[model samples]
Target: MAPLSIQAPDDGTVLGQLPTDDAASIDAKVKAAARAMAGWVDAGPMRRAEVLLQIAADTKAALPELAEKLSKEQGKTRKEALMELDRYIGPFIQYAGLATAVGGRHHQLGGGVAGHVERGPVGVTAAIVPWNFPASLFGSKLAPALAAGCGFLIKPAETTPLITLRLAEIAQVHLPEGLLDVVIGGPDVGELLVEHPGVARVAFTGSTAVGRRIAARAGQGLKRVSLELGGCDPFVLLAGADTGAAARALMGTRFYNAGQVCVAPKRLIVQDAVADEMIDLLTTRINRVVPGPSLAPESTMGPLHTERGRAVLEEQIADAVDAGAELVGGGRPDGERTGRGWFVRPALLLDPPQGARVRTEETFGPVLSVVRVRDEDEAIAVANETPYGLGASVWSADRQRAWDVARRIPAGYTWINALGRVYDELPFGGVRASGMGREHGVEALESYLEDRTFIYPAASH
Candidate 1:
């Protein structure tokens, strides 16, 4: 098989090449994981927690080098790359603590009957992670799955596999051999893992389209699956909200990592009373972004992770602009500063028609589609317009009103006057077309486990 090329999105430089895994190799890994499953489970929760904590410490010690590699290959700023590593390490500690707490209950029944429920590992789990925020997403899946005593196999996004590979290397030093492994390749490799009977569970983080395919394929094999997919999340600013704060929050979340985040505020819905001020403030913030190489200190924002991603974003912006939406801020930034990177100027599309691609599709770049509405009812109506229900945010001066509006949004995760910040202690996932199953909190750990009930005579006890 041809090796997968790992390129720096900042300049299209070939950073490294990794051997692509074939169906045979993937099958071998799956079988190996199955072999390792019992030993990993027998290691017990406390032992697993100790291993995870050690991995976290080693990862932190190697943070600088890892973050730089992540920044280059993933096309995120150095600061963002560091933050991603921080986010990645956190789940290990969190799941480590939670590992010891995983347990089942006993139930008493009438007529001398009793029941004891126990949870066990779901066997080998295949984690398919995407390029955007690869380390953090991978950690989120891996930590919980391992904490639940499942053997783990990861197939990282081909474009940004290096950092994940490095992480796996760091982690495997503390893990049982064959207990944690990585397969390097694209969709074909992923398909193998999903279809492999030895893989008891498949956890995926990517587009909704790809997620559906994984779900369908895994369903055939009766494999447990969790999908964290695309999102066109809405940021609704109700009347009487602090427009400046909203703008600042929008600027941070929407444009962070060049707006490649799945939970970023893709749709900006503002009540008429605050639309103008909100738009003006957001526009000013967008204009200040300096797009350049990810490793450059002066670059406030970095390039899109792929040429295809940049092209798709450009097409969305063009389609929206042609549909009579006002393009307020940045567009495609062309200059020596951008070099050969896949960079785009952060843009704000003001009041695009609901039918426009930017308003309809998940705009996966630094573009915010602004929609103005008459009142709160329209705001909630517009928020649920998209098929995605991954995440949404409601901003209002009145806490009760914001909470009320937040409740109306159909998203799985809604923020009331808060930025798009995901808490590790809380459950996070999506509804509608955004995919299924949760990724964080105890729920994620539980997904990797299966329960069994043992009922016998109480007199036997």
Candidate 2:
């Protein structure tokens, strides 16, 4: 069979071909992963940690090459790709240090009995990572899986599999056979991996709709599943907030990865008292963002990853505009950006209809919708209106007020006066339809581990 072709969003050029996998390939990988688990467990936590650290070292050594690959395949600038690739190593190191910390609990039972609870890996795991931020998301899964002694098959998104293929080559050289395997295909291959009888766990980072299907499939098999899914996050600008800083922060999140981030702020909720100022500041900053090819150093934003993505974004923009949303800066592409690349200008929408698709849906494009509210309570109401509770950001001069408002918002993670960011030390995930389970920190370790208890006589203990 002919392999699938990967087209670069920046230039519409063919990057490479990713060979398709079938049910048999997935079955073989699952069996191999199951076979590899015993050896990984025998190596113990410390040895696994050592190998994880070595992987981190290898990743860092190949940063430039990997970053270039990431840019070409994922349509991100080299600078941004470099930062993301560097972040990929952090989880490995963090999980390595945390391996020894994941200890079991001992409990005293009455009547001369004692109990011990242990945490251990689920064998033959599978990770389905999205195209956006592939390296970072994969690291979030791979690092903790290694520390917990789980063997997993990584299925990178069809649009961006080159970097992961290269990473797999490095893994084969440094880690045990079958410990890390990369299978390339679309959703069918992912479904095969999820429903495989031999696979015990599934970790996915993608759209909520797709995640629901994976979760249901995994649930049918009674398999452990972790989903880090979609978000239509809110950016709240309270009264007395610094308009300039808030605009900068908002644009920063919206323009990063060309606003393709699942946790990027989609709704801009501002106090009616300062709505005009916020709009003015946002339009000025957004206009300055140059939308060009991802490889260009001067371009602040890049094209959408696929033509379909651009089409969906354009449809949303048109709906919002027809519904009386004022296009303050950008909404359509023009001039040089109107060429072959799938580029959309950074758009600032003022007073868009609450029910507008751009306001309600996760546009996944460089579009920011502003909603003016009466007070803090209204701002909080608007923030939590979305079914997605992935992330939110609050900007206020009073730190205490920001914290208080952030606390009221129903989200898995919230930021005060800053945009969304993920770190290895902090737990990241969402509530509501955003996702189930968590990633990063000890929470991620828990997702891949299962608990077992042993009871014995006190004397035996």
Give the top-scoring candidate (lDDT).
Answer: 1
> Poorest 10 consecutive residues of model 2 by lDDT?
329-338
Task: Report the lDDT tens digits of candidate 1 across residue range 1-461.
Answer: 89988888888889998899998999898888888878888999999999999999999999999999899889899999999999999999999999999999988898999999999998899999999999999999999998998999999999988999899999999988898999989898899889998889999999999999999999999999999999999999888988877887888899999999999999999998888888778877877888988888999999998999988888888898899999977666888868688888888898899789987699999989999999999988888888999999999999999988898888899988876789999999999899899998999999999999999998897
Model 2 regions more than 4 Å off: 331-338
In order, the Cα lDDT scores of the candidates are: 0.90, 0.86
Total clashing pairs in model 2: 0
Q: Flag clash pairs in model 1.
A: none
Error of 2 at 141 (Å): 0.6
Superposed model 1: Cα runs more than 4 Å off:
none
Residue 431 of candidate 2: its Cα lDDT?
93
TM-score winner:
1
Q: Give candidate 1's error at residue 377 in angstroms.
A: 1.5
